[model samples]
Target: MEEVIVTVLSEVRCHLGEGPAYDVASDTAWWFDILERRLFEARLGKGEAQVHPLPVMASALAYVDDARQLIVAEDGLHVRRVADGHLALHVPIEADNAASRSNDARVHPSGTLWTSTMGRKAQTGAGAIYALHGGVLSRLFGNITIPNAICFSPDGGTGYFSDTHENVLHSVPLDPATGLPVGAPSALYRHHGEGGLDGAVTDAEGLIWCARWGAGCVDAYTPAGERVRTVRVPAKQTSCPVFVGADFGRMLVTSAYEDMDEAARAADPQHGRTFLLDLSARGRPEPRIKLGAI
Candidate 1:
C-alpha cells in the first residue's frame, strides 16, 4: 500500500484539536477541540466545519446507547443529546482525579465505551485506560501515561491501544460487550521518530492506521507492529483520525495548533484544519451509541 494525501476540508482554528468521529447514517463528521470546549460537525458533502461551544471541555466522544446522543470526555464524561435544537448533557462522569482527563474514546461493537486519560501537562505514563459498560466505569489498565490511538478488528476479537508519550502500542484481547481484557496486553511496536500518536482507525483488512501527532503523518501497521505505509499530513499536531464518508472511504483528520509560537505557526498554516483523505476503499466506521436525553 502507498501513503495517501490528506486535503484540508475546513479550518476551525481550534486551540487544541482532537476527537474525530463520523455519523455515517447522517453523512456527517463530529469532533472537538478540548481547550475550546466545543464540538464540531459537518455534513458529508459540506466543505466547511461548524463549531458548537459547550460549558465544559470535551476531550473525546463516543456513541451512547441512544442513537441521537453522544458521551463526551473532559473534566468528566457527559451525555450530549440533541433536544430542542441543542446538544445537552444527560449523564456525567465524575472523574475522581482532577489532574486526569480523557484524551480518546471508542465504542466497541458490543456497545461498551473505552477511553484513556493522561496527565494534565502531558506527562508520560500518568494516565489510565477505562471501560464504561452499561454506564459503569472500570479501570482496565494502569501506567498508560498517554493513551492515544485506538482501533479494533471487524470481528472484535483483537484490539489495539497506544500511548504516544511512551511511543508504544499494545495489543489486547477484547471482550466485545464488556470491553474487558481476557489476558495480559502484548507489546506491538513503538515510534522511533519525533512525534507521538493521536487517534487510529481499522481498515478493510484489519490493518491499523494511526495518526502521528507532531510528526505530520499517519501510518498503517500490522497487528504485530509492522509498518505498512505512511500518509503525510500537511500540518503539525495531527490529533485524530476516523474513517467517514459512504462506505468509510474518506479519512477524516483533526489537527491542533495548541501552544504554538509565531514561528511554529508560520511553519504550518494548516494547523487546526479538519482534513479529508480519500482511500482506495472505505473502512467501516464504529457505530455511535446514543445516551438518552435527561
Candidate 2:
C-alpha cells in the first residue's frame, strides 16, 4: 500500500463524534457530536465550521433534497430545513423507548436509508437495525449489542454491518432497486485486534473501508474479507468515515473522547478531532433519500 497523508479537518472536539456525510450539491460536509446534541457543517477546504444545536441526540442523517434533510435522532426521524435549521418530526422509530438512541447509518444506491439504535449505556442486546424506505421504517435485525458499520456496496446489491461488541462484519444480499435484503447475512470477517469495528464505507470498486474504534486506524478490505490496506489516524477512538471533495478523492473521519479519562485524554490530544485522508481509492456519492408515503 502507498503512504497516506492524514490532516486535521476540524479542531472542534466531540464527546462522541459519529456520523460524517457529504452533500455534493452544496459541496458541504456534515457531522455530529451525539452526546453534545450538536451538528457541525463546513465546506470542503473551508477553515471555519458552523455549529448548530440540536434538540435530540442524533447520530446519522441523509439528504432528502436540497432544501431538507432526514435526521435519525434518539426520538425519531426529523426533517430539517436547511435554510434555518428548523426541524419537524417526520417519522418515529422507537420513540416510546427512552433507553436507546440512534447510531451509525448510511443510504443505499436505491435511496433507502439503513440506520441503527443502541442503548445509551452500551447495554448488551439493547440495539437493533432498521431500514427506512418510502416513509416506512422496518426492523431488520434485533438483539444487537453495539450496531455500527452500516454501509452498502457500489451497485447496492450487497449490504454490510457490524456488531462492534462481537467484532464480526457481516454481508447480506439485497435487491438493488429497493435496498431490501434478498438473502440472510453471513459472516464476512472477524477481527481479533485491539479495537472493534466502528463505521465503514464502500468504495467505487466495492472495497470496504472500516474505522477501528480504539485502534486509531482505517482499514480497507476486499469483498472476500481480506485486509488489503491500513491508514493510521491521529485519534484513538476513530468513529466514522465519509467520502468528500468534488471528485470523492478524499475521506473525512470522525473521532470521539466519550469514554476517555483525563489521563487518556492527555495522552491522546487529538482524540475528538476530525481528520481528512488523501487516498488513491475513490467513492461514489450518497444517494438521495426518498421520503413520503409510497
Candidate 3:
C-alpha cells in the first residue's frame, strides 16, 4: 500500500487547538482551541474560518441531536446551537484545584458522549474519564494523567482511550445498551515516551489513526494494537486527527506548540496549525444519535 499524503491545510496558529471533527453535511471541518476557549469551523477551499468564542477550555466536539450543532467538551459540557450561536451549558465539570480541566472526547455509535480530564500542568494519574448520558454526566474511569484520543469500534462493542501522560493506551469493553465499559480496562499498548498518542480517528476497517503528539506524525494501528503506518508531520506535537468530508475519506490533523521550547517554536511557525491527509480509505462516519431526556 502507498503511504498516506499529509499536507498543511492551515498553519501553526490556533492558540492550542485540540479537538477536530469533520461535518460531512456542511462540507467543512470543525475543531477547537482548548486554551483559547473557542470553537471553529472551516470549509475546504473556503477563504476564512468561522470562530465562536466558548466558555472555559473547549477540548473535543461531535454532532449532537441537531446536525447544525455539537456536544462540546470544555471545562464542562456545552451545546452550541448553530443557528443562533446560543450555547447551552449542560454539565458543570469539577476542577481538581482550579488547575485541572477536561481533554479528549468521542461520541460513540450508540450516541453516548465520552471524554476525559487532565491536570493543568501534566501531573501524573490525576485525570479521569467520563460519559454524558441523557444530558447527565457520570464518571466512568480514572487514574488518567493525560487523557487524549477516544473512539469506538464500528460495532460499538469496544472503545479506545489513550493517556498521553504515561503513553499508555486502553481498550475498554463497551456495553452499547447503557453506553458504558463492561469491565476493568485492559492495556492495548504502551509507548516508551511519556507523551505522543493524542487525538485519534477510526477508519472504516476499524483501524485507528492516531496523532502521535511530540512525534510529529499520525500513526495508524491495527485492532490488535499493532502499528501499521505513520503520516510524518513537520510539527512535533501533533494534537489530534479525524476523518472528514463526505464518506470520511479526508483525514484532518491538528498540531500544537504549547509545550514546545522557545527555539522549537521559533523554528516552526506551523506547529499549531492543522493538516489534511488523503487516505486510501473512503466513507463518511456515522453521526452520533440523539437521545431524548432519560
Q: lDDT winner among the candidates?
A: 2
Question: Which tens-of-lDDT digit does each residue in 157-207 have in candidate 2?
Answer: 999999999999999999999999999999999999699998999999999
Clashes of each: 10, 0, 8
RMSD in Å for all candidates: 2.4, 1.2, 2.4
**Per-residue alpha-carbon lDDT of candidate 3 for residues 1-294, written as tens digits (9 for 90 to 100):** 235677777753776878887766667777888888777778875646777877667777777645345555545766677677677766667743576787888888878888787788878888888887776778988878888769888788888989886687788898977568887788898877534788887888888778888778878788799988876766777888888766677788887778678898888767888888787775347556454562
**Any idea what lDDT model 1 has?**
0.75
Predicted structure 3, TM vs. truth? 0.91
lDDT string for model 1 (1-294, tens) is 255766777766778888888776677788888887888878867565577878777777765533455646655666565442245544444456777767888877666667777887877678877776675667788787778776787777777888887788888997765557787888889778688877888887888889888988778888778988888788778888888887788788888998889999998988778788877755886865523233
| Worst ten in a row by lDDT for model 2 | 1-10
After superposition, candidate 2 runs with Cα above 4 Å error = 1-3
Candidate with best TM-score: 2
